[model samples]
Target chain A: MKDFEALKSIWHDQVALPKVSHEDVLKNLRKTRNGLASKLLIEMIGMGIAAAVLIYVWIASPFTMWTTHLAMIIFICCCIYYILAMISNYRRINYDKLLDKPECYINHLKKYKHDRYIFNTRKYKVYSIFFTAGFILYFIEISFMTSLWITVMGISFTFLWIALCYFVLMRIYIKREEAKLEEMIQNLERLHKQFEDTDQ
Target chain B: MSKEAQFKEIFQANSKKIYHLCYGYTGDDETANDLMQETFMKVWQNLDKFRNQALISTWIYRIAVNTCLSYLRVEKRQAKDELTDTIIETRGEEISEKNEQVSTLYKCIAQLEENERIIITMVLDELPYAEIAEISGISEGNLRVKIHRIKQKLTELYNRHERF
Candidate 1:
């Protein structure tokens, strides 16, 4: 039987060549840091641009109906809410407290995962409801101005699109996000259990 | 020294052991390399904030253990048996006899519990037992017991792989 010492000798006898150079690591560090920050930055910028355009439309358009103005306000609020949520999420995941003990880090990850699940499911539901309500209110004014067939077509198409999003797209997106979060949670929990086992 | 220079020194000192630790956990060279790089990236990011209360190596090890534990790519992680097969088939000719033995050793190490794998790799690297305990967040006495058990498990696995 090979003793532990023998195994240690074997382990030491093996040579490890560094596959990644220091420069490569530096390059990757810069790239990854910039990549995550830029992605979030782009998202926030997109939301800002969208909100700005909507405000401009609200100001420039000659809509006499109060419903249209309310719709525009609702749309702008959704954009602002989305931007704030994205910023919060970006801050949540980009934390620098990675030097915490394993159990603490695991707990941190579990909390983050829990928060993400709530945000993805419950928060998304709220956003969708508000968005659909805004669209419905907006459609009331359009229906008054347009022909009956046109209004019917427009309403049907909008509701169909909303139904598709609420039923199909949102479900798929939530399922994918949940799967990813669930896997991370499971891994963290296992590690947490391992730590507890050691403590015991 | 500049931050980059300081980081280079730290990386040069710890990267190899970190790679071995990751390799022991993953049993795959490419994955181990990726993990080592990732560990260093975190180290570089947080280097300025590092206080001197603990050894730099210990801090890096904590980051590495956390990184390995939190890695969620379940699909890319190969089972021990599959890893052994892939090693034999792909690098069979390219690897030397000693390298083959080392690979088998890593395969055996991969068979242990996740925490056990990390602990034993540190042990093999001859890290001070106190430092290992600190990095693993366990009492040194408990760590010794865990190491003894892991060594037995790893030896049994290594012998079994040898026979096969």
Candidate 2:
């Protein structure tokens, strides 16, 4: 390691040249450029669809039941919170200064995990309840105004949506996020331990 | 020059050096190649915004550094420890004194703080202090101090890991 100059000389000698031709870069750039716009468009379209449904439910809900009105209000509030939190997390991760230390990244990841836990466990539980309640109330009004078939169909749809989201969060997403952080932390910790070992 | 031409020239000039930057951060060929491509894609996209206020090389280096950091955060959580393994296997193909030297340096570098690793690699690549400071987003005075400390740590580790 004291061969610092020798190390530097060796580093300069190595080259990882691109196998792709300039023509390939130009072609890939065009494809990649299209990917950016399409991704933005898709996100906009998806958000538009979600916002349209939520806003419609809030505004055009023709329910005389106090329970129905209350449920809709709760659901709307939940939507607002979800959107705000998503934006907050994105900005928090992106806008923060790139801290140099691996420990700093580990610490940042810890905070991220903490926030995700709250979102998954606490906030999600509350959201599921409010969403289910909202649909149930809305369906009850449907039962009164229309046929039982329509109300049953609405309830079935609501339960299916809730179940899908629940399955995804519990089985797929949370585990994946946790495993990623834990694995990264393990590697980072080992690197730190190497230094400690060297000192000893 | 056309924007495409300008970008090609920039890519031609700095892509290998930037790949080394990515290599230092990732310490693996596959991930380093992925990161290098990502960095240049970003460079091509953001090229028009390069207002000539800073040196093009510094701007590009900053992009590479940030891209590498972000890539580490998202892509492969198991990177650093695997870095030592990568150096041995990747260098085996070349098998020379230079490869031996780089392999050892990379192992020592893996122990430094993530930012410290990037800074020292750039220093070892012999980028000027001003350019390093600009890319590292530190003042030159602070960079000198930081580099001095990192060098001492590297020397200690090298001596300890030295093959008898």
Candidate 3:
């Protein structure tokens, strides 16, 4: 190999840079800050819809059965729990936080990745179960009012939607997310290994 | 000078170095630009917090290293087609020999570990051992030892690539 000095000179000599003015920097900073705010707003909107549904059903529905009330409460609590967990995890992706010390960054990424995996694989199952169970209970009371055919169709559709959410929709999302995190972790581990290789 | 004016002057002086540091890690212009800007963005945001206890160059280089490492991602592979198109359109019909050498150097840099890349880049840029050690949060003696091993590996990698 040529001397490291030669390589250093080459690095120093290569100075081609695309023009980036101060205006560009300030504009992009504002854009990035807005982008973050919009992401949080979108997350809140999702939970807002969930909460709105909870209120609409609880207040407007005439079904007075104890099972219906219990099921609604279960669904509400689950939504709240999911939202809280998502918000807390969201903080991990902050630009400042992710750029902590190298080892700490890797550790944070690993824990965040693991928690996301659980939220998809395990937590989703539990979530589906409770939600499905709640719907079944709600449907039972509705079965009293609707015709037999309508009741059967309604129940079938509910279960089918839940099945699609678990087996198809959520699965695709989980796989994509997990793969992205895995790729990042692999890069970080490679970087960390570089240091270890040097030290040893 | 006002803080903003000071920052612009600093950026004018060091933006190229920061860009190359990023370019060395990613081996691509587009990603390097993104990382460089992200690094500077952090500097802008945290400029008030910089107490001047460390050399400004060391401090900014650390930020550049951490930013690039943190944002290293694989999703760009999916955009390979568009990236190729962009590269061709920008570079035009001729590829210079110097450009190839620089590209080869960066590709070699990409082979090293993240910390090694950051450290070696600092060394190549000729930052003093004391300042490099200060920013790296390592002692100068340990840094000297690490730098030796890192240079050896980089030389080996560079030779291995030259053979191909």
Candidate 4:
């Protein structure tokens, strides 16, 4: 009983709260950037969707009217947005930048596991709904020569997205493997620390 | 409330508990501190997705455990343990007076496999076996059995080291 009491006291006294501050926001931002596989997967899905959207539009009679032209222009703009998203991703990868801004990180990680959902949902968005919708739109605009040209351009851009995704994935895979190796080393180090503490 | 206010409340309430959880796993004050901050930062970032099913404390513990586990993967425990010895030495009287039993308890704890250690820690923190089982994705009955074994082992270890 005395021992139990003593142990409890020690547990309380020795265990102090660690001081964690806002930088953790940045740290997590860094972690997202560090998650290269996820990023690549997202990019690939995005490209695949763009391609399917193009094909769907081609099949659906290709819109050429002034209204269709405007709509196609909007679609192209969305495509450009997707492209810009991909480019930002690449730049992030290149600079080793993590999306660690405090507002974004806190909102994503703590406000609700928003990041996890976003992380999980990104694949579906790129590969399924977005792609399907995009292709259908493209086909509607297909009657327009301008739409055809845009579709062609979109296909080319899709290829670029795929190439970039592949490149990023390869790099991320290597980093992930490296991180795994590092993890193993850390475990061994902890064991060694425990042993040494015992010796002391 | 605005985002900043909400974030601040979470940081204040959970930071210490999160740190202790990390320390319980890492046994390093500084690393545990860093992990605690990281865990909260994650919680803050993912706050919106928290459907109120589980208690906030449970969620925080989950994050702390995962973070510590991942960090452990990269660190060389051997090197850190050596440094831990130095820390223990420097803080000998401070730690020893606190109760050598706790350190002994932790040493044995560190010996358990990762899953076992986590389950036991959750138990020690007074988390119900049901919650433990839920977080671990195991049956409550199984958790009871595992907890019994862990306690038995811990008792045996505590006795073994008590004589020294």
Candidate 5:
């Protein structure tokens, strides 16, 4: 069997050709700069656009009932709240700076995972409740303006959409996200333990 | 020097070693290539923030280490032992007998524990022990002991693979 010193000499003797070029990396840098729209950023922009349209409707088509005005306020608040939360979460991840040691990075990731779990479950539930209540209030005025069948259809669609989100989409999303996060955390923690084990 | 020019020089000097480190970790050329690009992408993004406290090589190694460690996000990690056959099969047609030995060495390295894989690769690359310890976040004393054990284990693995 070849000894460790011989193995080291063999390791040094092997040549490694560059698979990726400098130009390729530069091109990727430019491409990333131009196309760096994160999911959170997209969500923020969408919520901003929705809020703008809501404000336009509030101005152009005035509502008679106080409930409609209150609903508009609630809807706008939800959009703003969601956008802020996303921004906060985005900042917490610190996407630009990744210079921490492995142990520190693992801890940072664990904290982010815990925060996401709370946001996805508890904070999401509160947001959904407020959003649904806003829709119910808006529907009270909607019933008076539209025909009974139209109002019924509108409420049915809205509730059905919300129900689908709460029961199906949200459950699946949370499950997938949590599983990914858990796996990542477990892997990092195991690596961290390996480092620790060497010290002992 | 311009940042781009500096970055090009850094990439030229370090990319080969970084690829080796990544290949040592994953035992797959395609994945190692992707990871090397990812590590350089990060270095490009954060070049301005790099201080003069450490050797540029050490800093880059740290980034590469973190990049490899975080790679579990992209796909499920293949089991360590299963990696050898997959790598051999992927490169079997193109590799010379000498390169086949290199491939076998990588397969053995892949069977190591995650941190052991990183430490041994840096050792194989002939990095200074102090820098390896710093990059790995362990003391030099402990790193030496760890490297000694890893060397023994790797020798065992390589001999076993050769026997087969």
Candidate 6:
């Protein structure tokens, strides 16, 4: 090997990174998308507390026991609704693949547009169904006189928010593609310039 | 044993290689370490899906490359407001000679188009083309040509600097 190649080879061979302890790796692993589950568990606990509060308030109110029964039934249903949502979200979290190869997910986005599109599309469908169902369930639970208007407004806002988010994401993706093309062109120009100088 | 313990064992076995792959790409210890940690953090999170399709090393390499690429993107965005001359000059003062050479090589690497650099480096690391094709999602023939061109460029670069 020539001097530079020798140096480069030695550098490549001898330079090694030390292993972080198994303890640290596990600690970090525990914090991975496991945070999402931890969050859901926390949310579950919060929902339980909220449900308990609803029960306590409903029963203590001077209203009839039947109304209290209705309130308790509503609380139970809401808890069930959230539990199902949490499970669905957890299933879709990609926790297993993510822990093993977080960068693969990002690389897939940068290198494989079709895969990213497929992923985003699937996630969109899942989110839309979950949000729509939650909204419908909540709409059913509300006993106010203007509940219909509230439902209409609430549903409209959800759809509008989703549309706006999609619009912004598409714009960002388009801009990134444009920037990447521009960079490629500039790189090619520089490479050409280098060749031209060498020829001279 | 616990899933976390299993993950820890795997990471311990592979992280040094992972860090080197990261260092190969970034050529900076701090950035490489950060990328290495991020890769493992991601791996730890997704531990459940290490399907038998690919080796763990290949999966980690994929993650290392992806993290480096993302970091590059963010660095590019930051570059717009950066004092490029000052930053470039400062790099020489901070790093050792061998590291500086690696950094110089990486700077040259960045000038190549993204996939070209990726293919070439994977080849340099002596990974088989079939595995490279699998990781890059590029056909074997295309990867070969890209590697040829990248090596030609690097040789030209090395020759050019020799005259100085």
Q: Best-fitting candidate, measured by lDDT?
A: 1
lDDT of 6 by residue, A1-200 (tens): 13435434634644345445556655665676488667888998998887788677666855443543554565566566767766765665443333223224443334444444544566545555555554555444443434677768876886677667666775576667656655544544443453333223
lDDT of 5 at B113: 90
Highest DockQ: which candidate? 1
The window of 10 residues in a row where model 2 chain B has the poorest summed lDDT is: B84-93
| Predictions' DockQ, in order | 0.59, 0.24, 0.39, 0.16, 0.53, 0.22
Ordered list by TM-score, greatest first: 1, 5, 3, 2, 6, 4
lDDT of 3 at B4: 80
Misplaced by over 4 Å in model 6 are A1-22, A31-37, A51-88, A95-200, B1-9, B26-28, B42-54, B66-97, B158-164
What does the lDDT come to for candidate 1?
A: 0.84
Q: Could you tell me which 10 consecutive residues in candidate 5 chain B have the lowest summed lDDT?
A: B83-92
Off by over 4 Å in 3: B1-10, B44-59, B72-104, B153-164
| Residue runs of model 1 more than 4 Å from their true location after superposition | B84-95
Question: Listing candidates in order, what is each one's chain A TM-score?
Answer: 0.88, 0.70, 0.83, 0.28, 0.85, 0.36
DockQ of 4: 0.16
Candidate 3 C-alpha lDDT tens digits along B30-97: 88778888878877777777777346777787777777777746655422112222222235335555
Greater-lDDT candidate between 2 and 5: 5
Report the C-alpha displacement of residue A18, candidate 2, in angstroms. 4.5
Clashing pairs in 1: none
Off by over 4 Å in 4: A1-6, A22-200, B51-54, B78-96
Q: What is the lDDT of residue A138 in candidate 2?
A: 69
Candidate 3's residue-wise lDDT over A1-200, tens digit each?
57888788777766467356555776798898799879888888898798889979898988778888988888888888878877876665555643355555566666777887888888889889999998988887888888999999999999999999988999899888878887887877786676565445
Q: Model 5 over residues B6-39: C-alpha lDDT tens digits?
A: 9999999999999889988887777887889989
Using DockQ as the measure, name the better of candidate 1 and candidate 2: 1
The superposed Cα distance between candidate 4 and the true structure at residue A64, in angstroms, equals: 27
| Candidate 5 lDDT, A51-90, residue by residue in tens | 9999999989869999999999999999999888877865
Highest TM-score: which candidate?
1
lDDT by residue (tens digit), candidate 2, A1-200: 36567566667765445444445666777897688657656765665577678779667866688877777677667667666765665456332233233334445655666777788777888888888877777676678888888778878888998989887746587788778767656655664553343233
Q: By DockQ thresholds, what CAPRI class is model 5? A: medium
